[model samples]
Target: MIKQMPFVETDRLYLRGLEEEDVCDIYAYLSMEETREFLDLEQQQNIDQTWNLLYEEYLPYIEKSLFQCWVMEQKQSGKVIGHLRLYEEQQCLFVEMLLHPAYWKQGYMKEALMKMLQHVYTFLKHQNVYVKVRKENKNCIFLLESLGFQYITCVKEMLSNGKMYNMWIERLSEKEWRKQNEKNT
Candidate 1:
């Protein structure tokens, strides 16, 4: 097992490992149709179901070092706003995130993603990290581009709606991220 990740903090938020207690907070987003759109994830029917799903499916991610999920909480209100996930797959680190709709346009997800990128590169010593965003998710695409991620290709996915949509796979390399940060700082 890999070592547990240390808490990641930003100016307005704290990213820490998920606990069982976060089930309800997580369900708040996972149950929403808005949150499931770009992600194409299954919706949690209720809080009780969310708890069972997390306990059976995601709880291991917190215990195992190769995979991790951080619950993002606001520093002031102490409310759970989102989550950032990191896991090793196919010789690369895959990053994923979800945020409550109320927190949209607030820069909270941006800050969390930035912190995760640094951690995945600096702590995990990964050369590259990948994020797959639906082509329609302009916000995510813009965020990735702003962080120096380059578009790799578009993947076709057939969603539960039986409609085809394009998913863009973007990659950010450590060298590129460092270069951009150095130039800005």
Candidate 2:
């Protein structure tokens, strides 16, 4: 399949293709205690561990699958602050994002997420977008809810790291997105 690269521009951030160089930036958050607290994996202890996860695991799976990652960069400093992954699974487009703690509460993630939601609606024409978050990830839950995603149900799954998670699945339908956009306009 031919890849159609996505270049999404938001007011405060730019969503561009994620490269291998971004592994370090991604590890900045993945290595943190607070960020990993709700995540299924233990906090990364070294760069090698992060590299293995990103290179040996995720990269291969993403390469063969209908998935792409966008690294969020600050337009002013050109610093990578986070990354997001969009993939198709079970007939739904799924979006997952992670942001550095230093940049949290600044709305960058929200900006990137909004842009991708529009892309899914416009380009992918997906009926719904789904996201699964740990129930304890209050910040993520709040962000999803604020974006008009409805709580679908709770599910439990075992992570690759041998940990189990109680997650809340949420979804934003095309109808719901259209409704939200109508209100905004």
Candidate 3:
């Protein structure tokens, strides 16, 4: 089994490996119609289904070292607000993030993402980290672009749901990240 990763802290938030206690918070989002729109869930009827999915589907991926999920909590309020995942596939790291709808537009996600990117690049030594955002998620697209990610292409018939969505890929080399940081100093 893969060793459990440690908690990561940012300026305003803390990210730690998901625990069984997080089922309720996760279910709150997973069961929401608005949040499920871009996600792959067919439907979540009850807490038992959510619990099974979290344990059976998601936990196994974590145990196999194929994916890692982190629960995002506000440092000040100690409230669980969202989740972020790093998926290892085809020798690449794919990032997936979701925030509570109530916390949208507060810059919390950018803070969490910035910290995650740093950890993935500097600590994990992963050179190529990518994210796939829906074509209509303009807010997320703009956020990624502002973080130095460039537009790659739109993927057609990319999802199993028979929906064609835009796919934007970004690569951050260690050298590039260092140079970018130097400029900010």
Candidate 4:
């Protein structure tokens, strides 16, 4: 089992493990119609369903070293506002990110993503990371591209929820990461 790591701090948010107390906050955004648009869920989820997903499905992944789900909290208010996750499968790391509507356009998601990517590259030592965004989700695609991710291809049956989305993959070798940081400095 992968022991839960400590919270990661960004400029405006904190990315930490999802605790039982985060259920209400998670459900708030997840239940919203707008939030569900690009998501794979076909139907609006009820609190009970969300709870089961968190406990039965998500928690086990955390305990088994298969996934890491984080609750994004605004540092100033200490309020849980979104969720991000990195799942490891056969030496690859896949990222999933979502932010509440209220926090949109505030750069919280980008900060969280960059911090998490750094963590995976530096601490986890993963060779590559990937994220899938619905083709209609242009904003997310732009974000990923801006972060140096390359578009792989559009997948027809990529998700079980019946959404055909484009997949973007980003590979970061230790040498590449070091050069990126050095250039930034």
Candidate 5:
């Protein structure tokens, strides 16, 4: 249902496709234990794993337009600070994001997501955008809630990684997102 990931820009960041050079920066956060705490992924063991994930997995998927993976690049530093993945299934659009710990609580993610949400609701014409967060991920829950995402329900299931956890399903309707955007502006 989705096609190419278009490049998006905000005042402080650019959301663009992934590149080989981003592997090291991606590894920097993916390898951290704290970073993986609320995520379903295991802590990345080494740089090669991140390389394989980007080259063998992410790049091919992006090329085929299977899913959209965006690299969040800081405009001032021109450095990759995070990554975002978006996909649709069964008529529901889902979004996932990760930012380096060094940039945490800096409002960079909020900026990136606002741009992405605008694209999702406006250009894509999706009625609603959804995100699933582990229940214990208070920071993520707060962020999504602040963006007008409403709590849907909670699910307890085994993830692909063979881990079981309580996951909260949250959604933001286009109308509500537009309302929130209008308030922000």
Candidate 6:
């Protein structure tokens, strides 16, 4: 099992491990049609389904420390607004993230991801990380590009929509991220 991730904080958000109380807030986004479109998750019908997903699908792996997941809480309101999950495979880390539509375009996801990337490269000592964004998810693609991730390839992925869709695989190397960090700093 991998080590549990440490808490991460940013200017306006705190990224911490998941808790049982987070189900409701997570359901809010998972049930939204807008948020579900870009994600590969099936649209949840009710809170129970969300609970099942958390307890059965996610928590087991999380408990084993196989996957590092965090709930993004707004520092001011102390509300759970989003979540991020990651796992490493064959020396490359993979990322999955979701945020409430209400928080979209506000840089909340970017803030959380930037801090997460710092942790991955600095503390976790990962050399590279990757994320897969749907072709239609322009906002996410733009965000990844802004973070110094380069397009590796495009593949047809089966999404919640039940159809194969174009997905862009983007990768960011630690060396590249450090160079960009230096420029921005």
* TM-score against native, each model: 0.91, 0.88, 0.86, 0.85, 0.93, 0.93
Error of 5 at 47 (Å): 1.6
Ranking by TM-score: 6, 5, 1, 2, 3, 4
Mark the 10 consecutive residues where model 6 has the least summed lDDT. Answer: 60-69
Clashes of 6: 0
Query: Candidate 4, which ten residues in sequence have the lowest lDDT sum?
Result: 167-176
- lDDT (C-alpha) at residue 59 in model 6: 76
Better of 2 and 4 by TM-score: 2
lDDT of each: 0.83, 0.81, 0.75, 0.74, 0.87, 0.87
Candidate 2 accuracy as TM-score = 0.88
Pairs with steric clashes in candidate 1: none
lDDT by residue (tens digit), candidate 5, 9-118: 88889899888888888898999877777887767799998888777657887476667588999999888989888877677889988998889889998999998888
| Residue pairs that clash (backbone atoms under 3 angstroms), model 4 | none
Pairs of residues at least 3 apart in sequence or in different chains that clash in candidate 2: none
Segments of candidate 6 deviating more than 4 angstroms: 62-65, 89-91
- Candidate 3 per-residue lDDT, tens place, 40-100, comes to 5656778888889878856766456556677898899887789888886667678888887
Better of 3 and 6 by TM-score: 6
Question: Lowest lDDT 10-mer window, candidate 2?
Answer: 57-66
lDDT of 2 by residue, 127-173 (tens): 89999899988889998888899999999989878878898989999
Clashes of each: 0, 0, 0, 0, 0, 0
lDDT of 6 by residue, 1-185 (tens): 35466888889998998888889989988999998887778889999999999988667774665675788999998889999888765666898999999999999998999888898898888889999888889999999999999999999977656789898989999999999889878
Error of 2 at 103 (Å): 1.4
Model 2 Cα displacement at 82 (Å)? 0.9
Local distance difference test, candidate 1? 0.83
Candidate 4 ranges with C-alpha deviation above 4 Å:
1-3, 42-44, 89-91, 161-185
Candidate structures ordered by lDDT, highest first: 6, 5, 1, 2, 3, 4
Instruction: Give candidate 5 misplaced runs (Cα > 4 Å).
Output: 62-65
Worst 10 residues of 1 by lDDT: 57-66
